[model samples]
Target chain A: MYSTTYHRPATVDEAVALFAKGSDAKYLAGGHTLLPVMKQRLAAPSDVIDIARIPTLIGIEASSETLTIKAATTYFDILSSADVKRTIPAIAHLTSVLGDPAVRYRGTIGGSVATNDPTADYPAAVLALNATVKTNRREIPADAFFQGLFTTALENDEIITAIAFPIPEKAGYAKMRNPASRFALTAVFVAKLKSGEIRVTATGASQDGVMRVPVIEQALAANWSAAALEGITISEEGLMADIHGTSDYRANLIKVMAQRAVAAAG
Target chain B: MANVQLTVNGKAVSADVEDRTLLVQLLRDHLGLTGTHVGCDTSQCGACIVHIDGRAVKSCTTLVGQVDGANITTIEGISKGDELHPMQAAFRDNHGLQCGYCTPGMIMSAIDIVNRYGADLDEDTVRHELEGNICRCTGYHNIVKSVLDAASRMKLSIAAE
Candidate 1:
């Protein structure tokens, strides 16, 4: 384990100020990923900022049609919270199945989305829901925020403040999780927008992390049915290949999981 | 070092720990409250489960400073004098544990689950909720049974009182 200074700031401004002071500092939301890397000496930062105490990044707020999830709110919190389960409950349902009990209790929405781990479940949901990722500086559309593998649009000294997802008319998220780590092997998020539009996004299937499926979205827009994917072949281009699954398997999984998600949504 | 005080098992304990000190380390090293174990340094194992302000959290991942004034409850805090906590009694009666490495954390999480969602948890719900705590033994048959039984007993006891 590497020795490092730890800082816990009460406010987002205070946390961002420290990040500005030490540009190489890492923000600790769940330590679900960062701490393990730290102990393994894979990531050695001069300072570790524990932002769990940052009041600005905690709590869940729901207006009539929009559900705002504070960045650092734990997954289990979303899963168990009655208000969250009642409004935009797909978020709560998504949390209930993510990772494991320990990881869900520790992992934060902002941290997961910001990390852009290709195998993560949140990005697909964020993208499908057309959510807004609020940062210390500005609000970023989920489509633009996720750039590529282990990369995001978030800049140094920028802390994700909250994420706001508009409540959809009907929505569901489904995933085939990696058994050992429980990360999404390939997950699909399908939502029926109130305006009669349909969106579908796939995670853990592409090498570029999460990408919107225009074909599936188009098919669903025309006919939101499980049978829509019967003849369409999802492109396997630029997908990850690993011992867990091949690129072709993930490509096939995108169609299968998408069908499953659409079926569940219906 | 930060001077922090929190109530554990109904007694307030204060300590001076570095800002980086985890609650598990503070409880085990400083306070000698060994019931809260640290099974895996990775937050994978829920061996360090404890209740902070009535919600269950894995102590291994929580900073000591974070719970400074929160009403904290450990496994040691569960017993009411000579009588065991209902979950503990249920675990013992149902053979919910083997090697007993994960008992405290399991009990903590199980209690929280029952308190938050009631003991009406089905087998699948129990399994899903237990993703945080790992048990190599029992396949969770008796562990889940223990929590369900404890929920019934606690409800009856509360009703009787």
Candidate 2:
């Protein structure tokens, strides 16, 4: 790893001031992604502002209709949160299945969403549930937050504060994880909102990162059943193809995973 | 350089390390706690698993600066001076290891699993939770038995306390 200046600030204002002074700086939230990348020398930032210790960036709050999770909150926090489980059980389940026990202890939802890894589990949940990404500058809807693989609408200095997810009537997540890395090979999240609208999002299979499956959403909106997705083939276009699976195979997985997610929701 | 102070194995230790120095490096190199191995440095292998503030985390991926003022427990701290921890005793009794390369990480992770799930753990839960620790030897049969036996023994010890 490259030698970098480390700043541990107790408050957001201090962290922002430290960041503003650096030529190239990155917020160190949990450091699961950033540290690994730094280890490989893939990134060499001049400064690393440790936002993990900031008190304001670490918690989960649930209202009657929405779940607000601070960006720096770890997966372990979400898994153990009674409010999260009561308000959005699917997110709790997703957090439980993310990575392993060690990773869950340190990996933060904000870092995962900021990095926007296509195989990450949180993006599928965020996008399908129509969560709002709140940053220091502005709020970006889930639909507009994730741009593509390893990309987001976040500016260099804009730090994500929290994400607000509207509690759905019901939701479920299913993933076929890579045996070694535990990243999703193909995963889907199905959510049915109180407004009688359904949203389906697939991760790991999309070339453009987490994306909605309008066809599956349409089918489920019409009839909320696993059988409603039968014979509904996802187009192979713009789907990821790799050693693990072909584009056609991912398309097939999208259909199967959506069905399984619907069944799990039921 | 960054000055970090933390408690290790019930003793307070301080070090001046580079910002990029991993916790594993600080423990293994500076403190001479070589029991923690570094297999697959990319954080996939659980060889460097240690408890920071009572939670299992990969020390290899954690910057030493991040753990400032935190209490850390490595494999060396699991047992008392002469008596082995129950998990260690169970591994010995059940022949849970062959080469013993991954034993430290496996033991650390097992203690954490039992801490969370308690003695009533099933085989499937053990297998699922042990996903982070990889054991090439014993095909995980003896390792699984070891964890279960350790869990039961630990629970009995807790009850006796």
Q: Pick the candidate with the highest DockQ.
A: 2
**DockQ metric for all predictions:** 0.39, 0.85
**Which docking band does candidate 1 fall into?**
acceptable
| Model 2, span A105-198: residue lDDT tens | 9999999999999999999999999999999889999999999999999998888999999999999999998877889999999999888789
lDDT of 2 by residue, B1-161 (tens): 98999999999999999988999999999999999999888878798999998888899989988999999999999898999999999999999999998899999999999999999999999998988887766459999999999999999988998
List TM-scores of chain B, every candidate: 0.95, 0.98
Residue pairs with backbone atoms closer than 3 Å in model 1 (clashes): A101-B131, A101-B132, A102-B132
Clashes in model 2: which pairs? none
Evaluate all candidate structures by whole-model CA lDDT and list the values in order. 0.83, 0.92
Look at candidate 1 and tell me the lDDT of residue A234: 82
TM-score of chain A of 1: 0.96
Per-model tally of clashing residue pairs: 3, 0
Residue A156 shift from truth in candidate 2, angstroms: 0.7
